[model samples]
Target chain A: MDTIVAILAAAIVAGTPLVFAALGELVTEKAGVLNLGVEGTMLVGAVSGFATAATTGNVWFGVLAGMVAGVLMSGIFAILTLNLMANQVASGLALTLFGVGLSAFMGKPYESVTLAAQAPLEIPLLSQIPVLGPVLFKHQILVYVSWALFAGVSWFLYKSRAGLVLRSIGESPESAHAIGYPVIRIRYLATLFGGAMAGLGGVHLAEFYTPLWVEGMVAGRGWIALALVVFATWRPARVMVGAYLFGGVTIAQFFAQGAGVTITAQFLSSLPYLATIIVLVFISRDMATIRLNAPVSLGRPYRPD
Target chain B: MRTDKRITRRITGLAVGTALGLALSGAAYSQEPVKVGFVYVSPIGDAGWTYQHDQGRKELEKALGAKVTTKAVENVPEGADAERVIREFAAGGYKVVFTTSFGYMNPTIKVAEKFPSTVFMHATGYKSAKNVGVVNARFYEGRYLTGVIAGKMTKSNSAGYVAAFPIPEVVQGINAFAQGMRSVNPKAEVKVIWVNSWFDPGREREAANTLLSQGADIITHHTDSTAVVQAAEEKGKYAFGYHSDMSKYGPKAHLTATTHHWGGYYTKAVQDVMAGKWKTTNVWGGIKEGMIKLAPLNPAVPKDVADLVAAKEKDIAAGKLHPFQGPVKDNEGKERVAAGKTMGDEELSKMDFYVEGVQGKLPKK
Candidate 1:
């Protein structure tokens, strides 16, 4: 019972970053701009956040810096693909390569530095609930923030007037433009929002998750988040489920090894990626639903003449 | 017709310019500083594997001064990118290159063949060539001493190890640590978790937490991150840092660390190359050669335990104590080493089994 609670708690912690990044990407794709630079954006956010937190002794300041850095990084992608009319795939790839190199160079000074670990905020009374309290309530603030992000993103996408405009822009930018909606501007906003969320994901990693700065520390989580966005069919709720599922599988594998499971460590280590994809694929198999959820112009650059 | 004549004339002028430049460079060769290059698999962060190698590079720079100039490229991936970087160093007139990481073994050897005049040194690998040599420190020697400390300090009698891969080097550390722990406290056991990555702080932290939840009061990791130590610190548990001294990351929770010092070895290697005495050799130095040293024990450790560890460290350095000494048996109850015999380097390099006191099965390839 204790082990199950511990595994669930760990899954939430691990999945928080993915939730933030994937949700942000979901919005970006929904606005018809596929920002593949999620990895690079997260890296910049992570380094900047860690560096700020280390210097200011304020983790919140670090969070702000990370989000801003992420915005600026994605802003580059937005300009290249949206304004300059460059290829989206090429621009996104360049952003990732640039982010990897840039973060390494920027984080050189902070490599040896250490940060104080932030304690989780346990809700009074509510945390007394058996199993669920420890698994859900006992987590760092970012985990709660991620839950809020899921709720806010869901409401923003389905129940709001702006969401219809954004989704319409994603499905057919030309039609949306003909209807007098500012298509490119909405995409730029969506891309920047994605950048901010991706940055927060990185901040969660450098400040809250591991609380240290190391080059390539994002370590393909951004790519995983991007995959989650697609596999979840760009639905915000599914993205949340997929992220937690991946995190759960990752923690469970480690527990399995501790329990003397005879599975190869290599295979066990890969279980998270495999399990998340399989589960998400099985649930989202209906072709019509996938078509309805997927943004038609996701990776297409829009030029308003 | 006019353009053709101009192009031909330009080619002649460029050839003459190249010839004069080469002649000038040849004249200035002896007076120029010896160019040295270093390739690192991870960022030279404050602690862990690459940082220690970077420290050695700094020591080399300070020792040689103006006689040698060095360049270190950090966070270089261990495959095709490594080859390109190594070749660039050689092509850019670097006389000596140090490729620090086990994954660079094949790439170093391949690059050495193309750049015959350049000296290549790789770390923690078995392969070698006429121009490529390997240098590795016996890190397991320090691990055994730390295990002794963990064995003494832990109330739970279970130590958690977060390992990167099931490679021989990592396997040796796990087995040595188990042996040392059980030598002092027979009831003590080790639980192993493989993250399968040399550096991933998030996963490392999760693994450490899981180990702690499972009643492992002490923890250590083979991965290249301070996450385990930091995790132990946060959880109020003890931890042993690897690759470098990481007490600062977990001052309260850190017991001690098994640190690798490549400064002396690096300085000597540079000196050998300068003196034209460089050779392709597999140099595995340990406590005796000052390549591996135990970090100062935490004050929380009892005086008697510290003293015992100190004595054991000396025994290891003096060639009296072997981490893989006689009477060793695999977890499956199979005799790995006879009672009177110690494991040899050849067998040690191919180690694949977990010794007694390690609670999990060794993951197969």
Candidate 2:
């Protein structure tokens, strides 16, 4: 039970970055846009956040700077794909390359400088609960923010009238455009939103997860978050579940090692990727579910006639 | 996640095309200012492995003054790309190039085969070519000393070790630490948690926390990140740092650290190259040769314990103390070292057995 609680606590923390990034991508797909630049954008965000945190000595400022930097990165993607009608796949890949290069180039000086790790906020009465309190409530503010984003995204996609229009646009951008909805503008907004969320994920990593910016600190987390979006089939809540599940799989090796399990570290390290592939295979097997949840015009670019 | 960073990583090919023309102008001058290059696997991080190497570069520059010029390119991958970069340095007239990572061994050897005139040095790797030499530190000595202190200070009789991989270097450190602990407190045991990556702070921090929750009061790590020390700080637990002094990251929680000092070796190597006395010799330096130095003991350590560690450090420096001496037993109760014979450097390099008090078995190579 103690091991279970400890693992649960770590899973929540590990999954926070994925939750933010995947939720952002979920919103992007919901608007019929496919942005594959999350990794690059997150790197840019990570460095920018670290620089801001290191310079201003304020983690909050770092977060804000990270979001701004991520938006700037996606803005490049938006101009290329949305404004200039470039192929979404090629443009997204270009954005990732550009953002990653730019981040490493700029983040050279900030490498290895650490930000003070944020403390978990304990809710007064609620945090007094024995196991669950420490596991759930006593987390950095970003964890709660991720949960709130999940809730907000779910509510925004399902209950709001704007969400209805967004869903309709994702179903068929041409049809939505025929109905006078600004499909291109909505896609741009969604892409930028995804960028900002990815930035948050990167910042969460630098400020909370690792609290130090190493070169390549995001370390494929952006790509993992992208995989998480596919596994979730464009659902915000499922993204959270998938994120936490990946977290558990990722940390299980550590737990096994700590408990004196004699497994080789190489194989143990591969378990997370193995688990991801297995879960992705099972999740993708339900083609009907994916087809139902996936946006029909996800990768299709819309030019207003 | 995928190797996205590798795809986007910068190949910082900084070629300072200086007066190679003078050397090529038909005069074979051996004194034409030695050009040195360093291939860094990671950026010169604030205070880690690469950082220490970078510090050595500074020392080399200071010691050599105008006689030697050095250029370093950071974040270079250790596969074919490293071979290419190393060859670029050799072809571009760098007289000596140091490949400062274990992964760069084969590549360094491959590059050396083509440019035998350009001496190559690899760190922590066993393979040595005619032009390629190997150098490493007895980091286990510092680990053992820190373990002794941790053994004396811990109230819970448990110390946590967050390791990067199950490689021999990491395993040796774990065993040496356990040996140090058991020497001081026979009942004390070291718990092992492998983060699997050399520099993942999130995983390192999580592993440290998990170890603390599992009853470890003192923590140390073989990983690159400062997360374990930071985690120790927040948890109010004691910790010993590795690779670099990390007391700044964990002020009160830090007891001491085993830091790497490469300046002395780097300076000597460059001076030898300049003097035309460079050889393909393996250099395994320890506290005696001033390669592995310990950070100052934290004020939290008891005066007697600190004094005891200081005395042992002197013994280690004076060749009076051996951390992996006779009568060493593996965690499985198999006697690896007999009562009379100390473990030699050859066997120590391939160490794959945990000392008697480590919590886990050393993973198979």
TM-score winner among the candidates? 1
lDDT score at residue B294, model 1, on the 0-100 scale: 89
DockQ (C-alpha based) per candidate is 0.58, 0.46
lDDT of each: 0.92, 0.86
Lowest-sum lDDT 10-residue window in model 2 chain B: B9-18
What is the fnat score of candidate 2? 0.61
Chain A vs. true chain A, TM-score per model, equals 0.99, 0.96
| Residue-level lDDT tens digits of model 2 in B126-216 | 9998888999999999999998998898888988999987888888899889988888999999989877688677788878988898899
The best candidate in terms of DockQ: 1
Q: What tens-digit string does per-residue lDDT give for candidate 1 at A13-105?
A: 999999999999999999999888999999999999999999999999999999999999999999999999999999999999999999988
CA shift at A44, candidate 1, in angstroms?
A: 1.0
